[model samples]
Target: MDKDISEITDKWKNMNQTHIDTDEKIGPYLDKYFMKYKKTIYDSALSLFYALDTRNLRKSHKHEPISIQALKCFKDFVDRNQATIEEAFLEQKVILPACQFAIYRESETWISTICKYYHVESLPKADRIRLLQKTVNEKKFSSAAWFAIYAKVIREFNLQDIYVPLICQTRISVVEQLMKQDPAIAQDVVACMDKYIDNAGELASFARDIPGANFCLLNDKGIAKFAKRLAREYKVPIQICPRIDYNAKMNAIKFLFRRRYEQRKPMDKRTWETMIDSVFDLDSPASEDNNLVLELIYDLTNYQQYEEARRLAHLHRIPENKWPKLLLSNRSSPDRPLSRLGSGKIISDRNPKLVSVEPEKYSVDLPDDKIFYINSHEKFKEMNSYITKHPLLAIDTEWKPKLGLLNECNPKAALVQIACQDRIFVVDAVELCRDSEWATFVNAIINNPNLIKLGFSIHNDLRAISELIADMNIETKPESFIDYAQFHKSLVQAFKIPLPDYPASSGGLSKLAYTVLGKYLVKDDQYTNWAMRPLTTDKIIYAATDAYVLLEIHEKLESWCQERAINYEVLMKALLKKDSTKNKVNIK
Candidate 1:
């Protein structure tokens, strides 16, 4: 026994000397210490662990037999190597062993480490609860340590055997911490506590022990029976039952605000106050829906509570754009549209801001020999041949204008016009959508890497194509496509052109044609129903012009960009990158 003790002490001294002389890493020192003193190192291991720089042990690691000093030391390690430790802990193999170490240690810090490292789903229920129990039971009843351990145990191991008993015995401080950590667990814990307390007298006794036991937090999930029992016992009726269902309250508030706005219903101060009180709880979450909150701010403007409205806006985190500043600025005046002439209708259209182009300046007389109407499979094959022959094709889709109520109309493409050099083919969308051959041919063209598809507002056309494809249960996206609208924007930005301002998704065929071809593409039949069969000659020519003009504009734009020393390839790539980013879902 004396020999073993001497050997352990010598190993510790040597380890310390090595550690001090050359700042050695922890893993290497531990490896050597255990190897040399493997047989009798159990008693001296803690001392050796303490002697070395404890900074090597990451916070994610479950360092056993936790002391205040060790915990403090481990915290520093956690701070320094957080990302690395977190990454390693994410591995499935790493979690089990770390959790096992935490269990063996029977430590509050270790249990927390497990919770931090492994998700509840990743952990085995039996092992997690067992470790939780070991750590929690080892903690002293009334310290900060106990509160932390109890909270972790309750959160991590909510199984009835472990959770119910611990929650019933736990003091209010620990319960409060648990509630703050996870309100859902607090709900469960309160329910369990109520079950154990049984009669009103016993519950009152528990409440007396901890005066700050706020039972209001647990006023959810039919636990109202327990709350009512306690209230009856106290004779004050604490009014904890029928707790504010936040989501339902928000929905109601949103509906009311919508009605007030749409119906132009004047809401009185008393009614507004009642609406606010129903949704707003001083103790509960203040901000639920920013839209409804913004509406509430506007309503508050009617009440002349400007400062209070601003304060509420800030609390709800409503965006600065939605602040109702204009409404607030004109709060005293009657809300009505002003016109130059009294009782006269407001003419919305003013003088055209865009530079007008003559049709004859850029009109091309199409050779009747090349332009082919491809409605049948035979014409489609001939069009496919033309598509294969050409490296680039200008494409356009015309859809029937969706009419009627916004929600009732079904919109679809009526014409798909493809222009390849000399040949222009107008495929009937309604007829072509039914043919499997047409689907395969269309897929080939759209997905071809060698062929470039040129269009104006390409996303709109793509969306129309996607909708049509969905009807046939075929999914496709144009692989090599350029939106002239996107290109024009990038060109203006890159070349510093002094052109008239054109809104995004609006700088379409007419704008491009006017800018590049020096001619306005006529849009007389633009909104006409393209889905009607026995199509007009004027409609066919209109559809053909829209497709053919894209190629002309594209060539002109490319040449114009290249002449100015702008890297056309790099510029298009940048524009496409911007387009792709713009298409991404903005989640707010």
Candidate 2:
């Protein structure tokens, strides 16, 4: 006990007085003292008691158990230093073991002493509920614990009117523990529990009435039935939720075909045959997926059955505009495995084999207007004047892809893409990078807080721009930027959407293009060297389309949120929360 006391005193002496106000140091000090002394064998007839106050201390050994004596000491200390104890509690200095002392002694006054420091209305919802849980479940002080929980419920109700569901749905053990000593509250508790469960089921049914609520996992059978009925009546496509069994997938497929056939829009024969074969082809040396829509289309194309493949597209109602990219491209490639070096980063020996593409056939739907090429100072100045007036612009940049993770080559900015409502300006960063007008134009868009700059995965783009600005010796600050990829993730987690997990760092631009525009964006030129001079017509269209489409996608997202009654400001707050340990942005 002397050594434990000395160690704790040393820890306190080592800590600066300023840091004593922080809760971080108190837990360790208490933990060491308790670990050493509480576990030591002591005389059964006498137990140690130590009391600490700002101005005095009391120490004794009595016939009572150590925990009981400790509780008495704590009460005396609290009586003398009520303000200090409350402040300590607010700092979280009073830990579970200390609470255990008061609970084991069954001292209502001590419990009240602790409760006065914590108020439900003063804390966040989660924190307040956690405090209540600790108080109730700390020990078998059933009467005092129940009173605290019941009071907390009333306080929470007064604050937000959100307490009924929480109190009613609290763990059954809590109710059982409270009711063992207080049978008078049993009837009221059980009624609240039943009401909470019934209300939950009704909420699930209401959610199912929304169009995209297929993303929600429905546990209630009646709600699932309601969703299925709505899907059938509205002729909506059946979306598969997670954990679906083989039989469930088969039934959904059958239901889809039956509805389509009744409407005289029966699926094509070849496509149906292909779908059946893929569903039951578990023995085949390929991936197991029930849909097989993409695999079947590719197989038909590989067999040179273009006529039948095109007919399948027609039957599926694939927009004539979207069919070519959906059915035309080859994506399967041998993975370019990476090798590691001394720096603990992955690097590849060689790049992946590039697939052949017809540059002449590459096209993107754009306005029937000429794209401005700002290679000279005068054109650069003119473009900047036109773009700075718009409150919103879709922005993007082009740079040569890094050869490897640890590739030592310093990347040079290739192009800067800025698109407004009617025009796109593709700046030649190689030529205009040193020009003052170009730097000024870039500064205006990035630094203006009121000007909304929209992009996909803007982190890398900002880094590249930073590098470019540094080389030009320009001081600029970027603000009011929106990365749609992060926005999509916020929406997904917030709405509990059942989309497949995408790579967390990527923009998922290809998926967004298909979802929002109802067409595919050609990505064959994605990783090509953008620094090459005399850019091909295909590359020019790809660059312009990449920037221009962000504006269109933003419009679609706004409408989607408005239709679903999602508050845009509230959704953005979720995306801005940073995980301190991982240094990653996360949905709060």
Using TM-score as the measure, the top candidate is 1
Q: Please identify model 2 stretches exceeding 4 Å from their true place.
A: 1-365, 368-370, 405-407, 496-507, 567-588
In Å, residue 538's CA in model 2 sits off its true spot by 1.9
Q: Residues 304-370, candidate 1, lDDT per residue (tens digit)?
A: 5566566667676667677777654753544332222222222322134432432333444577666
lDDT against the true structure, per candidate, is 0.53, 0.49
Error of 2 at 163 (Å): 58
- Score candidate 2 by TM-score against the native: 0.39
Give model 1's TM-score versus the native structure: 0.41
Residue 74's lDDT within candidate 2 is: 38
Residue pair clashes in candidate 1: none
Candidate 2 clashes between residue pairs 3 or more apart in a chain or in different chains = none
